[model samples]
Target chain A: MQHEREHTLKAFDQDLDRLRALISEMGGLAEHAIGEAMRCLVERDVAGARRIVQDDKKLDALEIETERRVVQLIALRAPMAGDLRDSVAALKISGVVERIGDYAKNIARRVPELQDVGHLEPLSLLPEMARIATHMVHDVLDAFVNRDAEAAVKVAERDQALDDFYDSIFRTLLTFMMEKPNNISHATQLLFVAKNLERVGDHATNIAEMVYYAATGGQMTERLEKAGAL
Target chain B: MQHEREHTLKAFDQDLDRLRALISEMGGLAEHAIGEAMRCLVERDVAGARRIVQDDKKLDALEIETERRVVQLIALRAPMAGDLRDSVAALKISGVVERIGDYAKNIARRVPELQDVGHLEPLSLLPEMARIATHMVHDVLDAFVNRDAEAAVKVAERDQALDDFYDSIFRTLLTFMMEKPNNISHATQLLFVAKNLERVGDHATNIAEMVYYAATGGQMTERLEKAGAL
Candidate 1:
């Protein structure tokens, strides 16, 4: 009987591991989409941008699969307490990651529209901003895999830099638009791209909060209070 | 034993009803927030906008409560099949509804910024668009409560009109921006407000899809194909 119980436990662990693997897979695809979208933006690669948009469908499909797995895991295992909470968190994270992919797709869709605009100063800030946002996506998923709450908090902190970049970029674009009225069309597109990256940063922070909660089984704000980080 | 089983079934039904009630409350708050935000925008009611931002906290709190109730229901009931799927869908719909509230808060945040600029033509189109988006939220939640898949599909169909409003408003704002450089700043804010309303419509459609799936025990696309609506 003990051996049978041990086998059941092992199977449950395997199910959980599979769920985490799926989340990591989705995260990898979303991160790659962001980087590739940024590249397409700077290089004016319309075809590459279009491909990124197409690739978002994979992320969408993965999210559905993740949800299916989560429901099946709950129904079959009937996980109690922490295991159940983790499963639910995985479900929510998949949705957030899918949204991150959408933001990347949004950025990509603008590439064709932005092709006519000559190189602008604000464009230089975007790649670095994308890098930060992409890394937050990367590090947050790693935190989920390792169940590291501290690492998740650190990832949330990085959003401040992305926010600052967005503020600076917004001001620069506004000035640029006022200086040359003709720049309004293309400049508007760039503004949206910047906003999308900022939103990606926000979504990454949101995921970090979910990860922290899943790992510690407590609200992230409580963790912050204890660490005097709030 | 039969009596006991009946009692258990009734208790589960009550739990499900309570869950539905929480969702309805959240949906109402989100729908009202959208309308109030639009009113604040058009009237330049900075104080009202601030109140709307502050009120979003209640929606956030309600979502947390809904998640807690969901976890408890699943852990205690160990619901199988459709019951489990419906519970899961309820959890997701709460998240989506909370996001809709956030979009309203976003629109509210811009109210103060727009107070300085004179009224633009696009502003006139926004209230009607918001009304449609707000109604979608209300009708979709009603569909959830009623388990009416057909009603949910009707809500999804309304999104095209919102999309059309957005496109028209976009062109109008772009033309305005190009015509007068001074209009760029305020026009940009209006553009984001329009985009926010459009996003509310998208999220409402997303909830409609979820409601349709939960009600019909099938994906929305399948239902659409069957009805020749696709």
Candidate 2:
């Protein structure tokens, strides 16, 4: 009986590992979708945008599967302590992954409209913004995979950089519009593009916070607040 | 032992009701915030916007409390079947409410930026869009509270109204900039306001879908396809 009980413990452990692997896998896929979507924006690649939309299905399926597995694990194992933390975290992280996938889809959805609007006067800043936001998404996922607190902290702090880039784009576009009235059409679309990237940055920050929770079983954002950091 | 079991069942049912009430309260607060934020936009009332931001703390606190109670219930009761459905639905609904609050907060944050700028051409459509979206949020919450499937379906179908309004706002803002070069700054801010409303509309639709799920337990949006239906 004792041997059988030990065997079941091994099985539960395997399930936990599987859950982690699936989440990380989904996280990577979500990051790829974000990457290609950003690439679509900078390059004006409609086909790439289409791919992100098409690929979202797999991410969605993975998300639903992860949810089911977590619930089942909770039910079957009645997991407590660290196991419970992990199962709950998977649920929250899956929600975030699903949303990140949606953002990727959103970036693609704008491609068709933005493609019609011709390039804005200051194109470099928008793409540069996308580049940084995309990299932040990548870093947060990597941090999660390696359980790296420092990397997660880095991702969280990088949100301010995205904000700075957004402001720069806004100011540059403002000047461009003042110079040429017709630039308005392209500039508006670029604004949406920048806003989307900012939102993506926000989501990455959210994921980083989650990783902080996972790493320490304690919320790190609170620490940031206590330290008088925004 | 029999009496103790009966007491446990009664306590679990009461807990479920309390969870329902808690979500309804949060939903009510969020729905109010969205409405006030929209009114602030339409009236260009900075004070209203300030109110939304201030009230958001209340919503946030409610969210945290709701989450805590949910985890506690799950840990203590280990509910199954319908009881489990009720608790899980509360968790999902709380998330939807929290996001709605965030959207309201976003609208408020943008208000200060737009207060000085005269309401541009696209600004006209925002009020209508906000009205439609807020109604959707209210209706969805009503559906959840009353278990009214018809109301849920109605909210789902009305999402297109929000989309059409967004497109009108988008085009008008574009034309505003093209026709009058001086309106670029105001035009851009209005653009952000419209997009924020559109996003709030999406969150409204998300809540409506959740109402559908709680009432029907069938995931329609998955197979429904994203037809750019706002």
Best model number under DockQ: 1
lDDT of 2 at A161: 80
lDDT of 2 at A58: 93
Q: Please, what are the lDDT tens digits per residue for candidate 1 over residues B1-230?
A: 99988888788879989999999999999989989999999999999999999999999999999988887787677787778778988899999999999999999999998897776777998899899889999999999988889899999988998999899988888898889888888999988888888998999899999988888788887877888978
Query: How would you encode candidate 2's per-residue C-alpha lDDT over B56-164 as one tens digit per residue?
Result: 9898788768766776677778777656656666777787788888888888877777777754556666767777877787778777777666687778888787888
Error of 1 at B125 (Å): 2.1
lDDT of 2 at A136: 86
Where model 2 places Cα greater than 4 Å from the true spot, the runs are: A1-12, A116-121, A226-228, B1-9, B42-44, B118-124, B221-230
**What TM-score goes with each of the models?**
0.95, 0.89
Worst 10 residues of 1 chain B by lDDT: B74-83
